[model samples]
Target: MASTTVADGIVDRLIDWDVARVFGYAGDGVDPILAALRRKEDRIELVTARHEEMAAFMATGNAKYGGGPGVCLATQGPGAIHLLQGLYDAKLDRRPVVALVGQVVSTALGSGYQQEVDLHTLFKDVCAQYLQVAASPQQLPHVLDNAFRTALATSSPVCVIVPHDVQQAQAPEPGQQEHGIVVSSTAYARPRTIPDVDDLESAADLLCAGRRVAILVGQGAAGAEGPLREIAERLGAGITTSLLGKPLLDESLPYHCGVMGHLGTTASADLMAGCDTLLIVGSNDPWTEYYPAPGQAKAVQVDVAARNIGTKFPVDVALVGDAVSTLNALVPLLPAQAGWRPEVERSVTAWREVAGQRVAQRPSRLNPQLVVHELSEHLPADAQVAVDVGSVTYWYARFLRLPPGVPAHLSSTLASMGSAMPYGIAAKLLHPDRPVVALAGDGAMQMNGLSELITVADRWRGWADPRFVVLVLNNGDLAEVSWEQREMEGDPRFPTSQAVPSFPYAAYADLLGLRGLRVEDPARVGPVWAEALAADRPVVVEAVVDPDVPLLPPRQPEQKVRQTLRALEREAEGGQAHELLRAQRAHEEAR
Candidate 1:
């Protein structure tokens, strides 16, 4: 016999599913659920944040860090509205999180009650599953169970909205016999296959004949770091990474050029254009306008998903299977061609010296570079990190560095903000013991609502309050660029180029009962960072970073196209130490 209170049914189901945490602050709409938890304090503890937005973000961080479904609750109206950005993030990043929202009451469904907004309708686009617990007695537990199971099974976000009246009533028994969800792998998964001796021989024959060759990698190519390096060493070809695969192979490598995307390097694209053949592995990177205008170079792609073979751009050869295994077979074929390495090595070394230095120049504070540096050092190999869009993304490829095996979550198609929190919640929920962090911009955090910070602290389980450490770079703005706009180009005023007003980050953090540390001085960064780490609880380090810091490109032009590119990618094709003085003069025209 369960307790008759509506809160009991909700809490019982959450406990049964092993939900140890719930994000969001207590309020008028969801007070029943909070009060019920007070009676059953032995089962779950509530994390209270000052802002509803923090609750969702904290939940998102926990979800990514934990590797399961994270739960967050918020009041109706603005509170529920605040959780939207984080919810959207969980959906695209493929992290699972369950959102518990409060509603005014069933009786006032259409009467336009205070803080009355249709959360179901707003959530339709982002939630993997959404359910409203309007009717009481028999439907409450069933709806709660469905929301929980759906979030866990799909590795996506789900929403469960409980109306005020129904939440106080007795919950009816669960409709289903077993509380479980089902999942299956899609048929589109990449098949495993070994490259035959004949195929390798054919590939080697082509490579041996080509004067210039390049290798392009994607996220799917992550684990093949060793194999990728081996191939580059043997061939002496330029190594260009996709946005998803930048950190795996540092551009400092002799052959490394840059990340390939619309916002990627012109020199990388230039070198790629000069290539006779391009080797692609493990990713179907959607943005290809960076490669060339098409019909420019021959290409070969290999991946686990076979459909990605000819999907993005035209390819001369498409191999379907595991990239690592396929590359392993291809290595023997590469060593067979001995003469090409010398020619390729010469060009690779030259580009590295000039490009690496120019791109490395960046501000040490809150700019994208600093964001990358702080996160790289703070996020352990075992730790999980969730990224939000905007200037934060520039930091992703330009600054933050991750070692092998670290999972960095990002948006798939829609590069939207407000997603870091939900993804973080889902990570922490699933991977409880892991340290979860949300890398967000101030604007993104605010646009989503500020009350959910409390929800992250409460992660719902007994005594363990898993922390959702937020490293927020408050530049206070939004930034975007499409190829058409980058080309149509009136003014390249990246939103970050504009100035913004100050917000009360610390005051709000303290209000939420969260440890808030504000760093106004660059010199204080080291000590404050140590304090946050030492606190070992939910904390927000509001670092005021410069908005104008440039995202340094990993590739630069040779003493050639200085005018056409920014300082970083403006060097020539040899590894010789360039005379900075003369190099500037050579391309003074392009500038």
Candidate 2:
């Protein structure tokens, strides 16, 4: 009988779970696993990443795009530490992923080992399950199975730490008796929860009583798009989305109000404020102020997680079930109400017109909104977008209208910078035939490991089709933080937020053997985008934008305005009157 090492057993289990790829960097601690992977290279491919953080991000992206648990591997200590940011991104976003971490040899675990760290304690907050595989080889298969199962069942990351010595130990023989050694393929089941008949009736009654109804969607409502649209139409309701749920429905729908919250649309805010009944479906929008004030509107919430129901607001009726199933059940019981449809249509039209004006205005420097607007117009029907966190996210969220079926990936809950590029890479690897674009800010593009661009070039060089584009809004500063300083803190642009050295990102792309285009003129935006999109290789389009352009929220609170005015008064007294005047001009331009 052939004997297999624990590393080989782990690899075999991953293959059985249908994991076609793993992302990571090499290190001494993981050499045995690497050797086992090399032997099984034909079955599972390894994607070498420039940074361990990017590797974790790539795995998260894969889970987001591939509709399964993303897998990543990292070595002991520092390598594993670098994965925390990306792992946290997955945990917060509710993406299923499995991270395999290497550890020091079992005997040297607490002997002041060079690369030993208490990984369980370190990863406690970021993972749903943190397990260290036992030294015995017989324990490998059970640990691997549990790790994958927990990740999928909970829709969160799971970490399995393997000591270097354990990885090299021989597995039990094929015929050996073990308690949990069943090798047959087992299906990972997630049974859908259906709401009780009484609960559905109560929810329907609430909707029927209110004349003006509004629906709020989130990530949990992804598969329920058709059902949501149907229910919204049947009830003559206006629909708005949480930031993460923006792409659940096409924005071009007549009754669809864009996004709601700090980065929301005026129409959506107005719709939510005026509605007599609010139906929140599968969203846990943390911004309490954005929802209808307590006692202002009755609410009915539907969510699969029982804990999430009524967590954000007071729900008169709570339906606990899968969104698609619950929505379908509730729709049949709702009464058609056309009385509120016309008002919603009028509000949506007016909102779009005002939004159009903002995107149309030409500044002294190229406007970031216009760039996103043009990209939206030029993209293919099936194009996928990966948006970074910053001011650029504001434009993408507002300007880009994702048609139904086109996926848009973002670090929404975590709100992390530098996710765009890695997301784009993973999306392209999953759907090489489709067009993928990463919309990012200059600061975010630099922070989250821009060196991964070389990884893209190297991986896709020989591919038959590679259509990935990174569009950097190069404003030469952390524009979002600068805006926050002025708006939230009532402070002038301080050195901490203002000084970011401009780098030629396009030139850097060129050095990495990918197509690169630089656009300083607004007139060249369309042409450059066209050229870059048509390229057979991965491309970078760096569009220079005005740093002075302020990112104003759709609806500014009255208190915020008062604070800004008071800050301006303070600045005027400090012999910085010119700065106050500049702030006023920028605010006017944004409006």
Where in model 2 is the C-alpha error above 4 Å? 1-3, 178-185, 565-591
For model 1, residues 93-118, the per-residue Cα lDDT tens digits are: 55578888889988899899899998
Clashing pairs in 2: none
In model 1, state the lDDT of residue 491: 31
Compute the lDDT for candidate 2: 0.83
- Residue 180 in model 2: shift from native, Å? 9.0
lDDT of each: 0.63, 0.83
TM-score of each: 0.65, 0.94
